[model samples]
Target: MKNVLILGANGQIARIVAKRLLSEQADVQLTLYLRKSHRVDDLVAINSARVRTVDADIHDQEALDKAVQGQDIVFISNVDHDPDNELTQGVITAMIKNDVKRVIASNVLGIYGEVPGEYGRWNTEMLTQAGLNRARRSDELLEKSGLDYTTLRLPWLNDRDEVKYSITHKGESYVGVSGSRQSMADVVVKMIADPTYLNRESIGLADPDTQGLTRPVY
Candidate 1:
């Protein structure tokens, strides 16, 4: 069984990914890292045996290191305001110490504020600025650390009354260029299955009438 560690166990999407992985694959072990020890409603479908939760903050190096031990893949889905967000830095170190090779980090667009379009309008101006800035800083720090990383930049996310949607990589411009919008579930599926996206690249996502990798190629 491949052991996978997910940071931010209570995140909207991480729960989805855990089930998809266990359901889709036969042999898998899931460890969820969280600051608090709490059971989430989203994890109901999954068996308590396959899923284990740990109370550890990534900023705490020793606790994080213990949580990351013996895991093959680490998914970082934490977004909180910590001084320099040692969480991102902790991932890099944990991977090195544990000999884990694959890492998927969640980083959104406009961290540099270089790309802006449709998505920007949806966000309250200042709120968008601070959010993207943190994502950008997280990405920058992770990339320089020599860790194999995949950074997914998601657009406006919606779970209300929507059928399905499409995702675009780093390609064409859309009405919502501010960033992409993808379902927490859908995004998790793509990341785990697609190894081509394994190292050091940012993906922009969206929810549309069409679904999966739909921006007409980069």
Candidate 2:
């Protein structure tokens, strides 16, 4: 059995991904640490023996370290209004302590201009300057930590129905401010399936070309 640790697991995207993981393979066990008590009835309904939930602060190094023990894969979904960037740093330290090698982290697109042009620049600035320099600093530390990790630079997410999206590689030119966006579920699938993504690399995702969007691609 593969032990999976999911930070911010109560989130919409995280919950969606957890369900898919359950559907894909029962051998995957999910340990979700949530800061808030999200009263999602479906979460309680869907979780049986495969998924476990715990209320803990990612900022607490002792608690974080405890959570990291005996996990094969770790997913760090961003916390809303996460002030101190504790999760990012705590994840890295915890992983090192636990000897966990595979980490999948979510950051916003445009941090490095994976999406190019003015709009992409705007997007990057918006996230980077959104009152969380600690997050950026934490990410920088994670990149240099020398662990097998994948940093997903996700695009604007929409809660639409299931749809496949495109993965934006480094050096790609993002169109100016026009795109339908990727459903959160698809991004999670892409991240979990691709084990090759690592500390030095990032991938930006959006609706695939086959879906045919009316707006420009960014």
In model 1, the runs with Cα more than 4 Å from the true position are 41-45, 80-83, 118-124, 128-131, 161-165, 169-182, 208-218
* Per-prediction TM-score to the true structure, in the order listed: 0.78, 0.79
For candidate 2, the per-residue lDDT at 9 reads 79
List, residue by residue over 47-112, the lDDT tens digit for candidate 2: 667777767876778888888899888888773236756667778889998898888777665555
Clashes of 1: 8
Position 136, candidate 2: lDDT: 47
User: Backbone collision count in every prediction?
Assistant: 8, 1
Residue-level lDDT tens digits of model 1 in 62-163 = 888898898877888765344466677777887888888778887654455434443344442644666666767777776676777777765545445332
Relative to the unseen true structure, what is the C-alpha lDDT of residue 211 in candidate 1, on a scale of 0 to 100? 29
Residue 212, candidate 1: Cα error in Å is: 19
Task: Tell me the deviation in Å of residue 114 in model 2.
Answer: 3.6
